[model samples]
Target: MSFQGYLKTIKEKTGKGPEDFQALATEKGFVRDGQLQVKATEVTNWLKADFELGHGHAMAIYALLKGLKDQHSQ
Candidate 1:
């Protein structure tokens, strides 16, 4: 699926927005200078275990990295 599709799916599943999770992640120190570690598989595992994110939500971040999701970055 596309990045936006992943985002929309996550929103549908979790009832939250990208910024919502971004903020949560920021509060949790999962980021540094607006970047997370690349390692796609590791990221997915982290999301599932730490953030309770499912496949779709984890894929949203991947899509963002692949330039398939939101183009704007904070």
Candidate 2:
């Protein structure tokens, strides 16, 4: 699936968008001021355990959290 597809699915499943996740990540100390303070594995692990996301899907969210734009945006 495309990156946006993954993001869409994640929003459907989690009821949260990238901005929402960023807020939660900040609350969890995973991010600070829109920057990732933890390792990708740590973020992936959190997503896996809490959101039940697979690696690729979790990575898609991770990419967004790290300030990467969707390919379609380019």
lDDT of 2 at 37: 91
Measured with C-alpha atoms, the lDDT of residue 61 in candidate 2 is: 76
List the candidates' TM-scores in order: 0.60, 0.87
lDDT of 1 at 49: 85
Per-residue CA lDDT of candidate 1, range 9-54, in tens? 7778678777776666556556556775456676678678866888
Clash pairs (backbone) in predicted model 1 = none
Query: In model 1, which runs have C-alpha deviations exceeding 4 angstroms?
Result: 37-42, 50-52, 62-74
Q: Which candidate should be chosen as best, given TM-score against the real structure?
A: 2
| Model 1 whole-model lDDT (C-alpha atoms) | 0.65
Candidate RMSDs in order = 4.0, 1.9
lDDT score, residue 34, model 2? 66
lDDT of 2 by residue, 1-74 (tens): 88888888888988988888888889999988768898889989999999998999899878877777653442
Q: Candidate 2, 8: how far from true, in Å? A: 0.9
